[model samples]
Target chain A: MIGCGWGLVYGVLNSLSNIMLLPSAPFISIRPQIALPMAVGILLNPPAGFVVGFIGNMIGDGISGFGIWKFWNWHLANGLMGFIPGLIRYFGIVKIGTVREFGILQMSVVLASGIAVAFAVLLDVCFLHHMTFPSSFPSWILPAFLTDAVNGFVLVPVILLAFRKILLTLEIRTICLVTILLLLAVFSTAVSITLSILDDLVSQEAVIENFYIAGIVSVFLLVVGFLASVVFVRRFTDPVIRMSRASQEVESGHYDLSLLDPVSSRNDELGRLSRVLQKMAKTVQERERSLRQQVQDLQIKIDRKRKDEEVREIVETDYFRELKKKAKAFRSS
Target chain B: MAKIIAIHSFRGGTGKSNTTANLACLLAREGYRVGMVDTDIQSPGIHVLFDLDTNDIPYALNDYLWGKCDIARAAYDVTKTLGADATGRLFLVPSSIRAGDIARVLHYGYDVTLLKEGYRQLIRQLPLDYLFIDTHPGINEETLMSIATTDVLLIILRPDQQDYQGTAVTVEVSRQLEVPEMYIVLNKVPVRVDREALAAKAVSAYDCPVVGVLPHDEDMLDLGSSGIFSLRYPDHIISREMRRIVQRLTP
Candidate 1:
């Protein structure tokens, strides 16, 4: 239920944000395709898919202009999209075994979500706002449909793929660093937006002054972000350099050194290099094992050769002694 | 510096991921340090080839994106999982499979440049001899950025009409991006199909080197993302073809 609630919130927020941003870039509008699956996954699993989507979407929507009342209805409609898909899949009405199957499921939910959002928008415009469905409904609907389809078909899969890729990479420290960066971005964006809005409500001179202040602040934040990222990258690179050095040492038969700690710093790059070193260490260990086996085999061969030499020496001594005794006896006779 | 090789297909189901995984594994077997990244974050599935269960994945690309973990922490070292004969190291950076991560990213969207930075970071930090990026099929910010940064770009396609057109688009994009080296890998060709003719036709059409023409192998389907195909069936025809592709990739 909480998942569904979160999905509802995310759906509404995602729809609202897309609507707000739709005027500027029609091709890049937000859609509920991702939110729907996310909501369903979250509602079913909690704090997994639904919560993130819900929180993200709500934040995005809140950034737009939906009122509390309208937000609730929007949430309900959006939440339904996720709930329906989950229920259908759970009931075995839809199968999701392969990549293709998953794609189809995403399309269906997205299409359904698009329809629901359209209805919600229509309700808001006609009944709530007391305005006619804009002369732009046809144009808007098509783009919305396309955008949602793209979101479902393209974006959803990409997200899943990225998720899977990240899991495989297993760079937790990078994740934390990136998260901090994103939070900073969000915080910076919020502050900038707030300042601009405040400046708008004030006098011209105050607005100008505020704009100047905000610009300076934005630049400072951006610089900080860049510097932090650079530091992180540098930290990441240091380990790779160390790992390479260690690898070179190992190549020269120095196996006592261990891999550098990639996560010693908050840099994502170093952590990745550390992983490579760890991998290199494993390869070195295997080589060491093979080398050990070869040495043992060589030792056995050496022992066998020594035994053969001892046998040859004994045979030679006996033959020579016999020959000498025969010659003496012959001479004496 | 490790050479970053990106494998892309214009259309879906062109065997991009499988080909990437196989090539990476084959290179690793030959004592090369190879890393594979499934940058198709929206629909990630390469972990299956590495026998990685979702439960086993503690971090992912989504986690990296959401600031929950470092990209390196997301890399799973599957070399040990592969076995004793596998001398090369294989680390996989998988995308998140969780629905929430997917939704949050789509709804919020992150900086495309950040993803590019992540790629460069992965290459430099991992010190990868080869970083294979299995990208999403079509052109996107991430795909274009990866193409722009890659040292070698391998475009995978089948002998289908749709694929031909799509491959042309990707080839053109890679050319426009001025990728240092570009090669086309013709995959899933029928056994009865004339290899020489296919290669010639594809080469003439793309005006690029046809690195390898791999026959459709039933063994791949039977394995079904269970493990790296080339490593499991080293002597198989498909694996042999994959080796040819790897040879071209190597200096």
Candidate 2:
């Protein structure tokens, strides 16, 4: 009963969100609601997610006046989109607590989207005879997969994080920050391309010629910028990784100075960090050496003192006095 | 005759208590009747490594030292703490960890003669093959007494300068006492340090044989002296080294 109610609510919401398309970019509509059922599935159970997604899509189609079975394969695709992420939880990935889990969640989302869309298209080809493979794939299947996957990937983490299911460590923070910036860049470039094509001032011929150039140039910039950021981030992250490894070595008493040389030589913040770490390690090593020397010296001093104390302890005794007298008397005899 | 071994270090945190506990457990595991006495009354921690509850201890080494109870009465059968079936029995004479007991022991200081007698009584009552004494760090009156009475003196030290100097003094003192067998067990040695070279250096420094050179082990650190490391990680390199040290000490 609860699952059916959730499905009904989600179906209505999906229909409402689908009706609201961006004016500037009609074809590339924002469908943030798709990730709702996916998050529900993951947090609850796979079947709950499947029921909500499948029933919701069917109800949504009925409400939108597109006969419930008009796009039945697509409804199944949506159901699978919710169901696959839920399996992550089912398979003992109950929380996205670490970098590895975070990676798995993202990859699973993308993979599930691809598989579901491919399944839907195959069903369409087989039963409905709607898709014509090569021609229709670019127009229909590609967009469906990209939109759902991207939406699910972007939104599921946000919801999970809000629910305190995913921990935000330094690594996750860095990745999220970079991803948001990249998404902003892509969103703005796409909006600009759409606006350029829609602008009335540009003649048809001019629009056709310059729009292609603008699109190509923006795409080239995006790729180059993405690569540049990745490299920049790597410079900082790589040293941190190495420094952490070196720190572990120090922890286990493997104070080999050579382990830190590569990082210490760099001329950046991480280089400074490496230098500081090396200094700390060196100080600790020196302190250990000095500590041993100090203890050894103390021991020598204590040994001398103990010998004196030992002699005093024996001489103070009556037995030692008797022995001394006996020795003197024996010598006299 | 039951062999009495006093494991001491000049400095604290040299894994003295940990090594003593591990050695005792391993000895017992090998089907030898082993008994351990925590002589570090000021800071009785070896009991924790054995997982002995303070509340359960009706009589402690302090009680025996104060003549409140017999040494055998103070000894607890700690074989169950090892979590294994031992053909040979294991007993522990833990010192009182109570704050008042610690302060009292430090302030009044028990008779070294009585403490030594208590150890002998404990061994006799338990019928132990070996009795291991975990001593307080540094040379004190009680520590010297324990050292004098023990058949073997195992001086534990880290690969550090402070330990080196302290151990030198201990070695010199023990030599004067004429301990039958004195061995050095270097603890928390770094991985990169050449074990052979360090052992050689230690041998020359004190004219004592280096019985074991244990590497700084993460598992040991993680265990945090809560339990015996050697018994817990029998196949670990540190445990292997510990077993080797035991072999040398036994013979």
Candidate 3:
């Protein structure tokens, strides 16, 4: 199921990225760069993302009538993008704080996405299509670059933000959420594709036109597949954000942050996020207590200083009177 | 799934290379396919232990990192050199001993992430039971990265004040990285010192398990890096200790 779901994501990303067509102009489409975010997402959650991206892209291309040969080539190339990053994460090449380290993770994604798309185009034109080498390069390079760059710029950040929220809040068990999302994506894609095919067979319009409409709808469903994943992720994410904000308020000396009900286990991502927020709230409360103690200590010091001043005044007056009596006695003698 | 064990120390002269080579041999002897990587690009020497002369190494880890060759191409199988029944396979992915390659890599560091991908690719391609990473000493980008990914991190140290202080730094970093399991091996312990007392002190200091207390052996000095000690002299006491460590590692 996880494999199938990731496969769906890969499929949609591949289709949208349009690895199939090699445009002659150097125009950038905002689609190919989605591969970068998808690749990064897989790196974060491997089992689901890997299988989905790997097999899904292949299946997506296959169903689009790219022929089995082209499908495998594209699959191998795109799958490698996910596979390489996943391996790097597994082996500790790309550490957790890479984005913080280089400040170019976003840029790297765009660059790498462009490279992957370029490689995919190379594979398509060179290996699969058997086009003449340098001649075909001009036609494919521009479009691949533009599309990949756009996708990377747009999609990488969205995925990164989603991952950050999920990781920070502990809103969902990564494995479970990935599994569920992958299943939904696969189910939806299958249903949508099946419906389109049935509609084309039953209706009286030209098959190509019907198929085109079906393709568009399938692509739409794929987009929906990603949206559905976002929705599922968001369900648990919002409360985590609220709870974290509340904890931050408490940290800033606002002790009255609300203590709402603990997130339910069934709440998935949101539940995990809430649990973290609860811990943060406890920490904030501890800090606030410490601050209050420090304030009390300051007040005690002031009170002590006031009492000491009064005692000093009383002692000084008594001493002066005693000295005056002594002086008067001496003068009488 | 292959268990990727990265053999590391915070400082040099902790016997990291010797330990990695010996452990790989031990694992291979026990009917496990093991691959050893010499990631210490600056000072590569593991190849000598496998009796692989400079001329014999067709490709090195440096070549693979530079995209000149696939990682597997650099792997040198050295089971026959151990003088055991060659059923177990050991592939040595050595670093370039050439001064030029070393200088180039130091001047311009390759992508750390790419090295990681190479490690994974080696495991997948070879279907290795264990991949031993011989790392450079101290806290560097590569060492820290390897420690983060390892299933088992073995820190080799000698019973010296400098080594003790350095080991603490490595241990703390490993702890921060949240390594799943960590152990310390007290290597080259002098015969004069009470081994038990030293072991106790080490355990108390690090608060981690001590797998072995290997004595400084004259035979090891004589053999040097020509051959694996455990394989050549299975009856020796050091070999026995090494085997015990290997047993703990084997699943």
Candidate with the greatest TM-score versus the true structure: 2
lDDT of model 2, residue A119: 89
Per-candidate local distance difference test = 0.66, 0.79, 0.67
Off-target runs (Cα >4 Å) in candidate 3 are A1-333
Ranking by lDDT: 2, 3, 1
* Model 2: residue A128 alpha-carbon error in angstroms: 60
lDDT of 1 by residue, B1-251 (tens): 57888899878888898998888887887788888888888888888887787566789877776777778888888887557987778889998778887787778876554555566667667767888899888776667666766778999888776677667667665664567789989888766667777787778777899999998878888998778787778799888888888888887
Comparing 1 and 2 on lDDT, the stronger one: 2
Question: Model 1 residue A169 lDDT?
Answer: 30
DockQ of each: 0.01, 0.04, 0.00
- Fnat, model 3, is 0.00
Docking quality class, candidate 1: incorrect
Model 2: per-residue Cα lDDT at residue B40: 91
* RMSD each, Å: 36.6, 15.3, 36.3
Error of 2 at A83 (Å): 53
